[model samples]
Target: MTTTPDITLRSRLTTDCELHLPGDPGYDTARLAWNLAVAQRPAAVALPRTPEEVADVVRAAADAGLRVAPQTTGHGAAALGEQDLDDVVLVKLAALTGATVDPTARTARVLGGTQWQEVVEAAAPYGLTALHGSAPDVGVAGYLLGGGLSFYGRSHGVAVNSVRAAEVVTADGALVRASATENADLFWAVRGGGGNLGVVVALEIDLLPYAEVYAGMLLWDRERAPEVLPAWVEWSRTAPESATTSLRVMSFPPLPELPPFLSGRDLIIIDGAILETDADADAVLAPLRALGPEMDTFARVPAAALTQVHMDPPVPSPAVADHSVLGPLDDEAVATLLAQVGPGTRSGLMFAELRHLGGAFARPAAGGGVLASIAGDYALLCLAMAPTPEAVVAGKAAAFSVVRAMAPWAQASLVPTFAETRVDASRFYGDEEWERLLRIRAEVDPHRVFVANHAL
Candidate 1:
């Protein structure tokens, strides 16, 4: 007689999700990401197709005495530590990709597995777009779970704020919906809670009636940072909620892939943003543009040109990535940083970005949102390549110093994607929310089935 399989989480996941164990040929490559410093291999990689399948995989992992590591295109591929990674199921939901748009309501249905680029491309046809993180390849699930900020943050709000509903699979291998009406508290936690509760299957988010945006950058010389950095800050204070901006002080690799102006040089970049309107982008950019640029790539482009914001390399590279939120940018500190890591320093640091904050971002989500509580984030992104331990240490020190100098303005939140060491779960969650997450975990995943490689 044929035997029935166990319907618990593990039984459902055993086969439905693609499993790539250590001996698999592409396992090493699959376990890495755009950022090279972070990479790791779990006992197996589970590519789940649906919520039921994901639930099944988790149950199967539990049955097999394995922990689950959730992964999206955006996660650090190599940061897992040896102490906790002996036997784990790396959950990859890349197969659950696709998005549908509703132009009339300015909304779209996003599969938790879909990447930001997919949504950008899908919404273009309807003259509507989802304000997503800088990189198109960043997954929607991680972005939303991490309290997603976007290009349209000034005009709209975090990607989590735009979410109307979610379809999720609880730890028990049960599929359910979380909206205003059902599982309301769980929905609130997911908004800014950083996925501590459960895995989301699909997200229905509100879309903006955005067509073409005055989206592009204003490149300046490193010398201009003294003049431009603070100017951007001053400009931010008076900036209408309509415009969004960011300043980046970075060193370009001496690779042929870079343009002549930006190649082998330390440069400062200003990403100027605004909605699709008759507003003259140049007018807003004039203050920064006035400082002068050794090279400039600024221009009005289609919103789908998402890569331009971070200018993150399309091809993965061997590099180290880390970041911190700046509370403020003092002139002396800015000067010290420019002198140390900018143009002539030849510091081997790839990019240092300063994402402009305030505007709508400063406003807390009214009822609550599911995400790590990120109160204020004046983030500084530092990317570097460390061929030696000494170089890595130096780069880390330099990056930290910058953040330390700017710490006066740091909000209590951190982007988990950038965590290199230590994840204080309490810092990621507010009092009630943090307690609520633990309670949910106890009720749903009593075995502590999920543990993030980078802390909450």
Candidate 2:
């Protein structure tokens, strides 16, 4: 791979934005990704705080014959790491962050690098909230572009469907607006096409009207997986569209930093949002509650608090994961999953999760993007902490093992958000959708100047 000369890169981008060359003092820090497990060494890294700066950097990079890879928190860096970044300009958007809420319109206009927590907090006072992901620190651009699945998903729809418009800087450095009425095709492609076509600098997304929600978790010892797992799966099958939840068989290493209930323990967790009245939510949760969990935190809380319900690490950490969209889980399928991370099994995984999908999740939204709906019952995700190289190897093997074991019940499709590494991009969309995405990608980025986590 041929890299652009440092002098050429500096000459083009130095006046436009903050540029970090290979040997620059801040290059090492600027190139770090959220997933510490991924080591991405792009030819250079640029920090653009405004749309104009972003456009300048994009044009400069393309003029220098370098491909531009736009990244926010780098949560999905593993997928981008799979490519050759020797000739790529890593555009870190961490400096471009902010959010504005229009309560009257029930929408939020957020900068590309804004985190879910920012948007949640900004809208909380308005008694409104966006369909944010479980992790508060997750970048909005990457998540929505990849068809974000949320606790409100079953009741509403995938987060992308809530998007009204996006301001993107195309490969040619032209900033354009994409929505149902403006740059229509580009808008459709971007909703699920990820950052393959351009650098998304701003997005105006519709917010949920929920001021408060009934959501939380129920935990039981890992020993109860044999019983609790099946019960939750059964309940999920018949659960109303107003409820969305996930079941996880988790193993925690002995660490003093963790809470008593999670540290050095093997447990089963069931958690999510139940969009119903207090009485109605209780009735819907009766069956699972009957199983008698050691801890039940499900109750009515402010919608903003839902971002913390899943207890995702508030800070960046090293992790590796494998995922597959699964159809209805039968007895054999549940049994196979149990074999991998059952009570007595040493799966070496942090957690093996089955996010209950279906409900409105499987139905297409009107005027939605290419990835309007996920055609599966559950999204199976297995993740392992990978703080060390040896651990990364083991974690990958352990994670892939469970995914491979459950392949018989897995669907041919995948949810772009859950995918940890590069896979068949076509699996995320239908044949016609995939073809249309390709055509639009070629038109918007004829030279393939932009490289997204999941390339279209």
Candidate 3:
């Protein structure tokens, strides 16, 4: 049998908090995150039942001179897994799942640990939605704290840009409410700053009057990509911010439950989003529609149905994603991308998604939020969902090396969330932005109370 430690820390909290020891029943589950790549084992797992319980853990970790490596959900766990983590208390936030929506204000108050699916269902009654990821299972806390990307981001902006307030447990063990009027700088950093600042307990953010959407994807046969993708790129130049768009080159594996035309087929797929305010989205998208598709399923659909935009594999297969933000897609750059990962290549890759940027995504919000510097017109994202590790590595290298190969036109910086394993904060956020974030951390968390490590 194991015994509880005789430390002053655990005895100080007011709420009924539970601690999971090394060999305890829930310890493995508590320490485990969504990333299959991360193998983490914390000294103790603190499952706090209340905000004060959270503060207690923070206070105790500070007093014990231990840094905190917090995990709200596993959506952004890849970045977190690359740390030399030890003596850190894993603050497991699963029990803090409370949410409420104010329909009139178009806002939602979400607990620090809430998942995206919870928010979608809760906001459904109000005919509202907060900009969220395609995966319904992704975590809201982790997603927002790590710079939330969404299907609507091109139209509405990144998820972090919509935040109005955040309830945070700072490194000093104080529960501080950060908003525009209160601790304004910290609010800015947390919008896009990786969780290097503090542990967020709850978030209050704007929601949209969205229930229905003109969404879903159009899959085309592969032999036509050389004919298709280039013209689609030209149309991308004139697209309005109201429509978020992407083109992916995919080869879906043969299997039951997959679309008949898509299954066992190599396809040049064009995925689109037309944020309708009662306009004929099809008319706005006609040029690409004129390019013709072998299979088209574009029309009005439920917001929950928006996941089809990426047609991300519903199953968890081994995967590797390579990314680069593109400045412009002249014929040469576009052709290089198509030939490298597109249909004729068959380069052990699954899908190469080219998302259109610029427009509202590049414009600053009325009040500034998250990352503000990127004015790039496109983001080249390669989703390599291979069956084995070797394929993941080889595919990723070929894909991103092409990105580095195109560095003259690609943006020098990367979205910290999308960057894999090159932990340079400077490349993710420019030196000015990174320095400002560190300054805010110094003011709000002078003791360096949180743990943060990311790849560039």
Top TM-score prediction, candidate number: 2
Local accuracy by lDDT, each model: 0.67, 0.93, 0.73
- lDDT tens string, model 1, 1-456? 112222233344555566666768867766665555544656777788876678887667666667777777634543454225557667777878889998888888888788888898999888777868777787888778777668788767666788888887765657789888898877776676544556777889888776667777777777666677777776766667777777777776687978787787667777756764545666666666677765556666676775456676665555555566656656665666666565456655667677766677667666656452344536666767755667667766766665565565565666554444455656655677677776766765676666664433
| Candidate 3 deviant stretches above 4 angstroms | 1-16, 277-279, 313-317, 386-392, 395-399, 453-456
RMSD of each: 4.4, 1.1, 3.7
TM-score of each: 0.88, 0.98, 0.89
Candidate 1 global TM-score: 0.88
Error of 1 at 134 (Å): 1.0
Go through the candidates in order and give the clash count of each: 26, 0, 4
Q: Which stretches of candidate 2 lie over 4 Å from their true place?
A: 1-7, 14-16
lDDT of 3: 0.73
lDDT for position 249 in model 3: 82
lDDT leader: 2
Model 2: per-residue lDDT, tens digit, 1-456?
A: 265544487788645699998889999999999999999999899999999999999999888889999999999899998788888889988999999999999999999999999999999999999899899999999999999999999988888999999999999999999999999999999999998989999999999998999999999999999999999999998899999998999999889999999999999999999999999999999999999999999999999999989999878899999999999899999999999999899999999999988878788999999999888999999999999999999999999999999999999999999999899999999999999999999998999999988876
Compute the lDDT of residue 215 as modeled in candidate 3: 76
TM-score of 2: 0.98
Candidate 1 RMSD computed on C-alpha atoms after optimal superposition onto the true structure = 4.4
Q: What is the lDDT of residue 170 in candidate 2?
A: 98
The whole-model C-alpha lDDT of candidate 2 against the native structure comes to 0.93
Q: Candidate 2: which pairs clash?
A: none
| Candidate 3 local lDDT, 9-29, one digit each (tens) | 456555668877677898887
